[model samples]
Target: MSASASEGPVECGGDEFKTDKNLRTSLSGLPSKIVAGSGFHGFKLNVKNTGDRAYQRVDFGVFAAQVDEEDYFIDTSHLTLQYKDPASGTWKAISLDETDEGAGYLGYTDVKAHESFSIDLRLAVDKSAPAGLGYAISIGMYADDEGNCVFSGDGSYYEFDILKAGTAPGDPGNAKPQGGKKPLPQHQPAGNTKIEPQGHLAQTGSSSALPAIALAGGAAVALGAGAVFVVRRRRNADSGTAA
Candidate 1:
């Protein structure tokens, strides 16, 4: 059932459905590096339902942290998430609902079996976001009211660096996939929107302390549930962000 305009979409993290094995997701288009205070940056999220069961609703959430340091959460207040409306072909800001653990979530409905849909997403970094490396942005897709998640394998999260304004990013030709995972194909931006070149910046100082729980792997802490599955990596305990 499609959610009414007034009712909005269903909130994720409920016990409504079971996890589906055929669902898969991938992200592309975002640069490996961005400048602090950069305006809306674009990316594409593709969701594929490879099985035979059509889903009534699907929910997703995103959270970020400074992975180079333990428990150093980024200030998400300066961040904004937006999606391109398929019907209107216009960009709309998603009204984010926070989880008890502080992740942000929203939902979409009516995904038929064996079908695929793509969402054009934009992430706006406000001027106040601290600049540094080891920043990881993670996403989780849930069905069954947040009970079942799409497989938390490759492509669920992306790691990058945020350079201070006026700094050059690393050469794109020299860029390599982090954690030995292959890079997903980049999505082309629509209109005149400019995407920064993909690359990493040299690490600087320490990151400011913010409230966040550390998940064992880079997976997002599901709202009202245990940690969502994602790729695991050994943390570089010696590396820390600038305060």
Candidate 2:
């Protein structure tokens, strides 16, 4: 979406327009903590239209304020905002218009009925940003460039922290072994013995000599039985001849 520079200052009918219940907005993918002076962090803002009619010339803006003190606006001059262009699939800078209501407005086109759209946003917190908690960003949506209508419910706020330089959560140096215990040693093979591969016959504990021995035993038994049978037959024949 492109900014409407030619259009004069946007008047969002501050506090006069009722909150539109048909629209819903949400913010996600924001990191809970960020390092000051780091590169830009990416997040997403989504808007859904539950109403039957399409919203034309819709606009949304970003503003930051300290928690518990909404009236005291934080200086976001060091912050840079960029939105990904859906058509080109490339990131483009969004023009921030300083409004009288202390919010920076970015122009958007329309939200069709029963349709939802998402904007991928990248925010850079410069090194000048104070490292602490209680920092929050609010998004506001307005209908029509003339600002006749404002969508109150179609906005949300998210809170995050700015960390000091070279500091991050869950540092490895700060980690301690659990329950004061040492890790178990890894398994290793014993001593410098070389392992040789065995053949399939050796694996089964069988050898060629085993089958040969069995066959020789069987043949010897058969030969002894045949000799006894032949001797008995000759003895019967000789007895018959003598009779």
| Number of the top-ranking candidate, with TM-score as the measure | 1
Estimate, for each residue in 1-243, the C-alpha lDDT of model 2 and write its tens digit: 311112333332223553566766655676667677888878766667777866433445443322212223334456566766555567766433232321233334445567666767777777776665323332334433343434436333455666766676443221111111111111111111111111101112212111100011111212222233334445767788520
How close is every model to the real structure, measured as TM-score? 0.56, 0.54
Provide the overall lDDT of each model, using Cα atoms, as 2-decimal numbers: 0.41, 0.42
Q: Which stretches of candidate 2 lie over 4 Å from their true place?
A: 1-14, 65-73, 95-103, 134-147, 171-243
Candidate 2 local distance difference test against the native: 0.42
Worst 10 residues of 1 by lDDT: 185-194
lDDT of 1: 0.41
Q: Write the per-residue lDDT of candidate 1 for residues 1-243, one digit (tens) a residue.
A: 321111212233323323344766566676777776767678776667777765443444344433322233333455577766565567765433232222333333344557766667787666666675433333333323322233224333455666676667665221123332222111111111111111212122211121111111222332111111122322232244221
Off by over 4 Å in 1: 1-18, 64-71, 95-103, 133-155, 170-234, 237-243
